[model samples]
Target chain A: MTTPPLAETILSFLKKINPHQPLPTAEQNLFELALLSSSDFITLIQLLEEESGILLDFTQIDPAALASMQGLLAAFSAAETGSKL
Target chain B: MDHYPWLSPPDHTAQALRMDHHLWHYGQLMTHAELLSRAIDWSIAGPLRLLAILGNQDPWVYPAMLAAHRLGGGFLPLHPAFPSERLQHMLHQCQTRLLLVTSDGLATLDQLLPNLSDSMLCIITEDTKGNRPLLFPQHRFLDSTDLQQLPARPAHPAPNTQAAYVMFTSGSTGRAKGVAVSFANLHAYVRYWQTHHPIGPGDRVAQPADITFDLSIHPIFVSWASGALLCPIPPATRFAPARFILEQQLTVWVSVPSVAMMMERLNILRPALFPTIRLSLFCGEPLPTRTAEAWRQSTPQGRLLNLYGPTEATVAISAFEWQAESAQQEPPGNVPIGWTFPEQQAALLQEDGSLLLSAGTGDLCLAGSQVTGGYLADPDKSAAHYFYHPDSGATLWYRTGDWVQRREDGCLLFLNRVDQQIKRHGYRIELHEIEHVLRARVGHDWVAVIPWPGGTQPVRALVACVAAEENSPTADWLQHCRQHLPSYMVPSRIMVVPQLPLNHNGKINRAALQQLVQATLFPTEAT
Candidate 1:
């Protein structure tokens, strides 16, 4: 999946499970805080893999990889190419 | 004298709740005090035997507790998931004169009333819709109004040292022991925990485990002591509990590692769910390293603490916070229990009785006010477990049969239990505990119990019984067990064997039986 698509998928999965949170966006801001949480990030990754067929290893994804929507997109690209984007 | 209600006076009401619409507003919970006061009034005159049907994550537990106190009657909280027989055994064992069932929970008692009618009094907590209350012809149903009309005249306090609650602990002897934790021990425990950990008004706590499991004390007493809102969560949703945590904004989270693993599987770690989870406490079993790592990774800002203790030690003896940096420094799966709680005094004692305070692994010895006086109605077992220290004549310590090693950092890491006790999926299981219940119900002389957890998440039991019995063990055992043990402790499969394998010493070799289970070749292998 493309970077924007991966971010959108994760954002949507988080939205589905916990509707209490204001809707997350593909843009980088407070949405980055969701990736910092292990439970939310794992949920995002699992949904991303199931929906978009992109494999994200929790250990491999660094802070910068989840810093912004563009950065998350790039990380997906790196994961697709089997290297750090 | 210390107050009978040992809780510190409540202050900072804003700290009373974190998440909104979770259970009740502070004002609503206060209204329960009057309701609870009325319920307590009814119980003061006679022995009120109450069986608390605990499963629904209702915040109404506090009021039920207040009512239980007012009646001068002790509570027998049973897991709703417990099979009919186990529930019956609990009701009979407690000599439960009164039962408190929720309106939605009336159907569970239908099958086991015959066995329970002698001592059981069925009391419904809420009203059912269309179903008229059927009289078992012998059982009495107490309604919500009956709860409200509880007499106001006060009675003497129930014996604090007597068995207030008796839940089964798993053992190797194939029988579950009813670990009777007294009100004094529970009271002392919460008091000690409060002095050290200190909870207050605004703290919202989650009751995640089934109440039958002793670990549920975290939500129960912690909330009561601090006047914090106690939000009970269903056991089914324990795995994906982050949803509730997020929805409710709970500040305190209590659960077992297996439940934590389930949470990881369900993916509830988004920031929205865990923003307020400051105190993430794990007990009932060791926090698996992978699970701990997941928690550390997920809630980087949250404080992860691990508590270790048996029901015999009240609720917990020692605790350690999972320092993210420290855990990251160590290899995977090497998480250590960090330290003892401030109020608790613990020491590792060798089999020879010499204190292993400096180094080495031994049975964890617990000493403090929180140590229960003794087991109920089982003096022999209690004498064998509670020992007086030789050096100090007055200092008594309870031998916690659990094996653990003291780390260089002063934290203790739990090894295997010395006896045949196993902590499966956060339940302290004694194989013999199940066997005892089985024998009591089935009248069987020869029975060998072993856990078979090769595939299923819950550690199901494989029972080997005398093959010559006219009635072979089957699903009926499940019904029989439901009367005595909690639902999780029941054996899933029973295999009747002509004879059990005995070693050269002529004792039943559990390892051999476990091997048979592991190979999936007990009486027969699956297709």
Candidate 2:
């Protein structure tokens, strides 16, 4: 199962939040970031990817993306523009 | 000389460990270890230095461990994924004398270095054998480079009494406790392979468990001794292992049941799809019969066993062989932990705390050569869990805190835990560990964490219930969890209830809370 990079990152993020239910399309962000710590929410995901065994492709996840749908879409848009998710 | 098969691979030229989509022979494996041991010798002075290997599933991690033992001291394999603070606590608790870090792991170690006052030697290594370049450049650390010569001699194995490896597990007091396994305990576990399971050369055993997890030890020792290949499935790819399995033609499979369940969710565990799998072993959590059935169906020719043990008891002590014909006969709920290994002794602890030799349901306690010595630097904690029972003869018994029932057939059925420790995703978590971090915020102690959709289903995430008043902002409580706990320990969802329901005993009733969380989040789950 080769998931597109964006979908894989989104899937991992979704797993952390709603692990049981598969929800929210890529464009649709039912995000709840009230709990994201400053350390985890970074602009670039290089540091997280470096840590081995992590499932999420940090590039697909914008540290600020989960704050709201706009942030999520903007992050995806940035990723589409070739920014690391 | 004790013939510890694991310490010496039979064929130096045989394919040894496979990782990062590359095959590394035993020659390269031993050379890497020799280079690491030589590096340790140059940096550290003592013979009994405790070496903490800090890295992910990077190629050099295992060699680092071998290097630690080569120096005549013990090794503590740490997961770089853990928060730096937790790593620092472990390093400090051991008063570590030697540390080995893969170049990629240096970033996390960098955060911990300043706080550690103990002047120790740090060796920076890469998958030099795998030809991966150093992720970072520096003169401050020693790197594993071109490695050629074989170890001088498999010098008689280290004294059985000396520490072999120390595994730090989740703690309720907000600090992880290190369970130190002696050379004797590890050897006993490896010896289990000789009489039972009888695996040897040509077996391509799967390596999914992190080095931090004791489950990983089975492949490391068993494969090395038998000249079987230790095929490592990298972390990011572990979730989607079907491709890797078929590609590697992995003959032996091992993992926590959670990983199999995830594979089932992905819909790839089809019938007779993996004929190459000759053996499958699942541990670290309850193995649902449905999951086992699907797994067995996927590998029709493979034999499956559910093994059970605590970290205090090295790796696994008991195993239950699963058969397709006996599906109807298998005990309800999870597969029974079955009988203890031949060399091991198992006794049940009644509610009165008295030990029972047989035929009763209570706490599971193990006593044998496989039981580990007490935790490092924590005598009080050790005393509380490990004890010499009047009936245990000479072996010290370690209380597993697992509630188990001895069936009429003498096989043991795992029911649940006696305490707050719950195994989720093959990772042991102390519920109190999460509660400990949230206690300061909710002074009235109106906080409780319950597994979601709390029924027969495997726990997906933790749902924490907090008093509405204390958790007004909501994000603060979650952010607090995110800041303090590891990602696994953090509660995925926060429920701001007006007040928590209480039991007749007046203590916060976790049982009722579990039901409440189930009812609230999953109303249709059939409470």
lDDT: which candidate is best?
Answer: 2
Worst 10 residues of 1 chain B by lDDT: B39-48
**Sliding window of 10 residues with minimal summed lDDT for model 2 chain B:** B130-139
Error at B66, model 1, angstroms: 2.0
TM-score of chain B of each: 0.79, 0.91
lDDT of 1 by residue, B1-527 (tens): 12224233354233332222454544444445345445332342223344355434344545455456544445556655566755655555455555555533556656556666474455555643123345465655555677566754443466665445556665454434556666777777787667777767777788776666788776776676777777776533454555566666777778877667755564544333366777788887767676776776666557877888878887787777777676557556536666666656777887777877666799888887667766544567778788888765677788888788887767788776787666676777776777777777667657767765422233324443433354554546655765566655656456656667889999887777677656643334231
Q: Quality of candidate 1's docking, in CAPRI categories?
A: incorrect
Off by over 4 Å in 1: A1-85, B1-22, B36-59, B70-73, B109-114, B117-123, B127-141, B146-166, B171-176, B180-184, B265-273, B328-334, B353-355, B435-449, B452-485, B492-527
* Off by more than 4 A, model 2: A1-85, B1-10, B41-48, B126-140, B144-156, B441-444, B455-457, B524-527
Candidate 2, residues B242-282: lDDT per residue as tens digits? 76788789999999887787666545577998899999999
Look at candidate 2 and give me any clashing residue pairs. Answer: A59-A84, A59-A85, A60-A85, A61-A85
Query: What is the fnat value (0 to 1) for candidate 2?
Result: 0.03
The true-versus-predicted C-alpha distance at residue B432 of model 2, in Å, is 0.5
